[model samples]
Target: MEKFKSFLKRKDIEISAKRYLIDALGAMAQGLFCSLLIGTIINTFGTQFKIPFLTSPVAVIGGTEYTAGGIASAMSGPAMSIAIGYALKCPPLVLFSLTAAGFAANALGGAGGPLAVLFIAVISAELGKAVSKETRIDILVTPLVTVMAGILLSWLIAPPLGKAAMSVGSLIMWATELQPLLMGILVAVLTGMALTLPISSAAICAALGLTGLAGGAAVAGCCAQMVGFAVMSFKENKWGGLVSQGIGTSMLQMGNIIK
Candidate 1:
């Protein structure tokens, strides 16, 4: 339909980049909650927690043991997708439809799950957007079509793409490990720059499964940016500057830094 075409036109590559990549993936996906939930809390606190539920691992037949963190990690994909859908201005039906798509893409993509969620969620959102409010029986028609289409796409496309991304990420990670000294500094600097550049370094790290020495370097780089900015702006901004840069994001001062 003409209406569908118009809706699709509205969601050009540029718009998708802004809505999915910057707003949803960067700000919300890798923001405070995710950082705490999946990053620090799950990785640090959860590991240290002595609670039975938190520490006890449940074994699956022919599969790795499931822990609290693993469960939380599984949920991250859908959560990130919903955030993307909401940012893309999807209707309730469409947004929920993306949950299914996100789960499939993330699961299929494996270690590179978030990237898959981003890509599939965008496709699913746009498809849903095309049909949003197009009919009076939107409640029925909209959801039915969106969910079906999204699931179908997930089945057809998500798995192989996810494997490919994971494969590429594995190669990069292996390379980083093989040359830790040089790669560490490079990754740290680049990921640090990415953190301040209105992009999701956390997402990138997660997508690539960047761990070990390289991950440590990446953390150092992020800390350098935050600390460097916080210290530089101490005279004028004071505590606000500290909280914003040190505890918040160095990106807050991007304009002043650029100026």
Candidate 2:
């Protein structure tokens, strides 16, 4: 255990909640933004404006043609997994191998894909790192370990994780429908609070498939936090702060909020 801790320190692999939850998870959000969010934006823009190239079919796969945006959106899992690996400072091979694991987790996990990618990617990267440079044929061993771990985890846990996440999401949605007035406030407050934390509320929303009334409440909550921070800090931060926190993220104000 001492040796392992020493090794981790040598490799700069700090094992802490802040590292995983704040750093890696935050990076995961960027991955989500790049692949899923950006893709959704492209598709929506193309469709809404009827732009020719954006709307045009770029490629065909599995008997279906996909636009550029569709292709980008479809690769969200790989993108997110890679992002997590990058954030975790994984070795080159371990980082690359996460691509396969991410795809498997996302595909198998369905609505809970993001969460699966988060967990599986972290494990696979770490496992791969463990085997990395351990042998004369390090190139072969590292990738092999990473890919196998990712594949096995996807097969074993991805589906169940997806189901569990979706179940909670469904329950939230059902409650919102059944008691719109009360659940709305509850969801709003909770999601708003989440937005201000280091954790990714968007990832949680994506994992749980938060939509309909629940989705609206979540959006409202996010907006409230953002706007609240902007307003509260206006005297100290001024307009620049207001714009950044208001439209950007109240996350930056986390320190002040804590104080």
TM-score of each: 0.62, 0.76
lDDT score, residue 249, model 1?
69
Q: List the residue pairs that clash in candidate 1.
A: none
What is the Cα-based lDDT of residue 15 in candidate 2?
75
In candidate 2, how many Å is residue 121 off?
0.6
Task: Output candidate 1 Cα RMSD.
Answer: 6.1
Clashes of each: 0, 0
Q: Write the per-residue lDDT of candidate 1 for residues 87-149, one digit (tens) a residue.
A: 777878888877777777666765455556667777778777777787899888877776777
Task: Evaluate model 2: give its TM-score.
Answer: 0.76
For residues 49-134, write the lDDT of model 2, one tens digit per residue: 99999999999999999898989888888998999999999989889999999899988986667778888988888888777887
Model 1 spans with C-alpha error above 4 angstroms = 1-17, 27-36, 57-69, 167-180, 187-259
* Model 2 steric clash pairs: none
